[model samples]
Target: MIEVKQLTKRYGGTTAVKDLTFTVDPGQVTGFLGPNGSGKSTTLRMILGLHEPTSGTVTVEGRPFRSRPRGLRHVGSLLDAQEVHGGRSAVAHLSALARSNRIPRRRVDEVLERVGLAEVAGRRIGGFSLGMKQRLGIAAALLGDAPVLLFDEPLNGLDPEGVKWVRDLFRGLAAEGRTVFVSSHLMSEMEHTADQLIVIGRGELIAAESLEEFSARGTRQSVMVGTPDTEILRDLLAAEGAAVRADGRLLTVTGLSAARVGEIALVHRVPLHHLSTRSGSLEEAFMELTADSVQYLAGEPR
Candidate 1:
């Protein structure tokens, strides 16, 4: 598990993170979400001990990560896939990390194969595409077989297949009781992959809870109703203080529940063809919750 308590970081007069407290438990994938310039990268660096916190503390598996020898053996992180030496072969790069952490040289080959880079093990990283480089970085993270892994935008340059593979890989690792923390801007991917979420904005914690709970925080719940008497139902629903939008025989309703809509329709003897509730998606929830936290707002397109 990873624990952060009242963590804060400052650079000169600017505060990058403030009093952030959260725990990333094992046996599940936790997503780190925030808008641009929201201090996500800064927080990740602090967690890896790359940046010192002005105050508070961070620990992996009950102790400071910097206090542990062979850090990779405990926490594996991929902060930047492109940070590796471009001239080195994939195998050579993994080999160096393995040797530094006193890991077996053979483990390099295992991780390379696992990440689908064994075929290009001898190729120089400079010649690889962005996606290939991402794979190599993932290989290095797996080199130590660490129980706690942290990834920042691991899906940045991946194809659909690679993305799916990564999703499955994280799930597999969590099933084995490893702590998997992922930081990504892709809400759809997080919706499918993460079991929990840690949301921050402007260096402060917004939410730290299960994915379901966070999603449920969105207030844009609506009911979809299909009826032949679309105009009649629209007027009837409007009378109940519900906003209703009509498209032919279908009506989208807000400020009401599916059961209530059904009741209203039945009471008025309006036959209904279909009725279902539609909850807001993760992206919608994120946008709504982080609206004020966004640093750069674009104006309407011309």
Candidate 2:
């Protein structure tokens, strides 16, 4: 488990992270999300002690990360996928880390096979593609066989297949009672991967909740009706206290379900051409939630 309490960091005139607080628990994948320059990387760095916070603290397993005995054995992290030496073979690279940490040399091979990089164990990292490097980074993270894992943008350069592989891998890890904390800018990608989300914007914590709950808060069950008798249907629905928006041939109705909308049309005797419920995409809900606090907002029209 990892806990960040009122964490804050500043760089002279600019604040990189602000009083952020969140807890990552075991047995689930917690997704961290924000736009670029939103201080996501800065927060991760602070958690791992790579960046000293101006205030607040981060702890791993109930104690400060630095003070925890055999801390790396409790937490495995992949902040950068290209941290390995280009000249070194994959096997040799892992071997060096394992030996330095007094980890069994067998773990190197085990994790190499685990990440499906066993065949390329002898290949130099310089010859590997971005996806291959990402896998290698994952292999290194698992080399410790730690209970907690933190990955920042592990899907950045991966192909679709690789993305799914990583997604499944994270779920598998959490299923085995490990704590998986992953960060990414793609909301759609994290939609199914993470059970909970910790969202931040403008260097501050915005919202943290279960994925389903978060989406539900931003939207509700609504139905869209399309018919030629738009004027009549709108009047009927409006009289029933349903919020209606008419956009060309489509009418968006809120505060009513699909079945209710159908019943309303039947009662009013309005000929309905098409009626269906419209569900909001998780990405849309996320964008709307962080719109005001987004750090890199587009310029307004002149």
Candidate 3:
């Protein structure tokens, strides 16, 4: 497991991460979420020892990463997959990493095949497409078969099939009892993939919990009713404290359940064509939760 306790980082007058505390347990996929300039990459860098925290601590298995001489054997990561040398072949890159970390050379070939890069193993990275480069980066991460993995925007340039493939690949890794932590800005993609979510904004932790519990926090369940007697039903439901809004022949009623709304319509002798409870979508709920935390605001048209 990875533990972050009151971790904070500063660059001159600007603070990137602030007093953040969280834990990433094994055998699950934890998604780190935030918008642009929300300090996600900064936090990831601190965790990987690429940046020093101004205060507090982050540890993997009860110690700082730099304390381990064979760090790659404990944690595998793909941060900025495109930050590789374009002059080197995929095999050469992995081989170099393996040699430095004392990993077997055959492990390079195994990881290349595992990430579907064996066919292009000898090809220079400059000739690889964005998706292929991403695959090669993942192959390098898996070369050591480490117990923990971290990926940042792993689906950035992949097609739909490639996106799904990577999603399932992370899920499978977590099922094998590995610690998988991925970061993404896309909530819809995360909704389909992550079992747990850690959401932050402007360097502050907004939420950290299971996806179900996070989604459940936005359950402002409302009933949508369509009837010819819209005006009458709207007034009746309003009088019953149902927070009713009328749009054409439809009444959007909140602060009440579907059954209560139906009973009110029946008792009031109103005809109903449609009555359905609208549960909040995760995206909708997320917008509501982080509406204030959005750092970049587009201006209205002139």
RMSD of each: 2.2, 3.3, 3.2
Q: Score candidate 1 by TM-score against the native.
A: 0.93
User: Could you give candidate 3's per-residue lDDT for residues 41-85 as a string of tens digits?
Assistant: 998888888899999999987788888788789889999888999
lDDT of 2 at 106: 98
**lDDT per residue as tens, model 1, 213-234:** 8888965898999999999999
Best by TM-score: 1
Off by over 4 Å in 1: 229-232, 245-249, 267-269, 300-302
The top-ranked prediction according to lDDT is: 1
Better of 1 and 3 by lDDT: 1
Better of 2 and 3 by TM-score: 3
Error of 3 at 263 (Å): 2.9
